[model samples]
Target: MTGQEENGATRKGPTRALVLHPDLKSERRRRAPELALAEAVSLAAALADLAVTGAEVVRLARPQPGMLFGAGKIEELKARIEADEVELVLIDGPVTPVQQRNLEREWKVKLLDRTGLILEIFADRAHTREGVLQVELAALSYQRTRLVRAWTHLERQRGGLGFVGGPGETQIEADRRAIDEEVVKIRRQLAKVVRTRELHRAARRKVPFPIVALVGYTNAGKSTLFNRMTGAEVLAKDMLFATLDPTMRGVLLPSGKKVILSDTVGFISDLPTQLVAAFRATLEEVLEADLILHVRDIAHPETEEQAADVREILESLGVEEEVPVFEVWNKIDLLTLEQRAALLVQDARTPGIHTVSALSGEGLEALLDAISTALDDRRTIETLTLGFEEGRARAWLHEQGVVKAERDGDEGHEMTVALTERQRAQLERLRQG
Candidate 1:
């Protein structure tokens, strides 16, 4: 059988899937197993063609090396799967290649671990060229690791390292070599796309508009808020990984200051390592942001945990410490009146936090006012000394319309300029360069 056939019997309609979250006793748990299972179900729902037939948290004292579950549990699950006619089993945790192969053979169903499931979702949601390439690259990297003897499709094609290929090459080795070659090819394509993105970013920088990035956990109403703030019709569905690619729109703030608003892919707990590396470029917008709005789904039960995960991802992405961040407590409409009132009271007291319901437009005015105030360009007049050789810095200051007066001196030029903090930083960079 081909790899796809071995994965699952060919079906004409939606694939019936069973979601399982392993509640291992020995593992240090970060999230409740029930909640994790619910999330897994939601993730399965994100795929249009997947029909989740059932979901549950399966408890385990320990994992079997080859099967990942004991004989009794395996047989029980197999019976249940057969009874339910489930074609796919989605495990909400890591599963090794050997265990996956064994489980598929024992259960007579295709198996997808957490990473594989996520890759499938990404593959389905990716739209842009770069997004598609990144997902393909991540999938290839993931597939290379799971190239067992059962994946017969890999043996049909062979083109890499012509001299090394002969009767001596094993199927698994050929498959891995092909995947590696594809990875290299995709990297080259990604580099070109990244260069184009950089050029666009450079052009945006010249526009003098600060970039305000909306970042949060998946399904946290970031896209809804982006649409609300910019009046742009971006996909704002309440789905995990709904917005896979970065989108930017120009918005005139309430204070008449124009800023570029960016909506980026949402973060998730325990994001696959392959995706984290592959989608790094997609999240680079967060790094260049002059201000970040950390939108939160306040209605979610695991709101605090989700916030921590977002912060962890942000820190890992190397977001600068100096960039200002505003915590946006979104989805207030989902809260009860008493809860909303109490949240508003707390939001009023907090300096950097705002509560709003992006869907209903409640508290959006105040949020906008706060965003305007935060991005206000309060200027300061200062005397700057630039050497004659530092013409680029002087030109930049003049180009920014910050230079008020200038005079030539023996060692350099003395200039009086009104500068915002951003301009000062830009000038400093120009000098350093």
Candidate 2:
């Protein structure tokens, strides 16, 4: 996927994209190094649609107080951009407003950092009203911070007074003000959306279906696995961040009990703060899930690192509650027999782990049975006898779980029921009278 661009290389749209890898050495050395590499790869895949020719990695000696990268690197990058005729410069790191403006002036091309590119992808992928609002809010927050960058909005109105307005009230400032206003408006709109979603969740709460959320590193085939599990086409692809919106579908497990499975946006190491703020609504799906299926690509070299990154992100979001997590080592079809056995043995040592190839439908029935058993284990089974007059409890028991046996004796209709711990407790309280 790497190449060199030719001079006067015209394309139907933009062809050449200059990618710069800015390593936050201090951060990586302190927190995690493998995650940094995963971020770089995810950024490359995010910009895959831009016809990227090649990428350069700028390993910073030390963090510059003003700009992240040094002046010498910037000069060399400018020369490289001109020589390659790159139209779009994608920085695989965060760029400040002043640094972004300076880079554009020095390189003389369209400059975008990791946060900006993720927002752009979200803007394209968002479909629902809430998702669109969240994206807009995040975009405005990001743009408001980086107001010095040159774009179509800046060229319109420069500095002026009287007819135009004050120099402070120029186009950029005005746009910032408008974005601020829009942010507030979008927040209000999202509040409504949140209320609507809460209502839907409350309705689902009445049902006894256990919820499972599919989570993994970006481009780890989460949506593909989701499609295979629920038979729902929710934008499966080989690119990073392919699925932005959350999709939920019901899956009937082997136990004949219906369970809900949700496909969510993939996680990436060092995901932008603006994006985290914007996609909170979507991530809420994972938080509310009854079980989490942490799908991983066993064939990937950095699979363990990716798993650590996913765990870190989940812990940060406070979803590390005792909700059972099943480690599903996916993409086993691509692995060799030795690799598969090794992974299986390793997974066996870890509690509640399984191996499956979602694409080839191998070892899926076992996975389903595992899910069913996990769901059933979470419930407290109770043996109960119901009178004939309590038809409502009998119906509730049938709806919730299995009704083992019933006898219509001389006194009334006696029934034995198996239900969840909560349901059993509630029935016990009812039968006490």
Top-scoring candidate (lDDT): 1
lDDT of 1 by residue, 168-250 (tens): 22478777777888889989998999899888876665566677899999999999999998899998897898999899999
Off by over 4 Å in 1: 1-11, 149-170, 377-381, 391-409, 413-433
lDDT of 2 at 231: 89
Q: Mark the regions of model 2 whose C-alpha exceeds 4 Å error after superposition.
A: 1-11, 30-42, 47-49, 150-170, 382-433
TM-score of each: 0.89, 0.80
lDDT of each: 0.83, 0.73
> What is residue 252's positional error in candidate 2, in angstroms?
1.0
Task: Tell me model 2's lDDT, rounded to 2 decimals.
Answer: 0.73
TM-score quality measure for candidate 1? 0.89
- For residues 1-433, what per-residue lDDT tens digits would candidate 2 score against the true structure? 1222338662444347766776655654433444554455556556434566677666776767666678888787778888988777777777777877666667767677777777766766778888878877777777777666422322323211011111222367767777677778888999999999988876776676778899998878889889888988788877788888899999998889799999988887668888787787788878867789999887887788789989998988888456778888889999989988897887668777888888898878888999998878877544455677877766666655456677777766676665554455556666664
Q: Per-residue lDDT for 291 in model 2?
A: 83
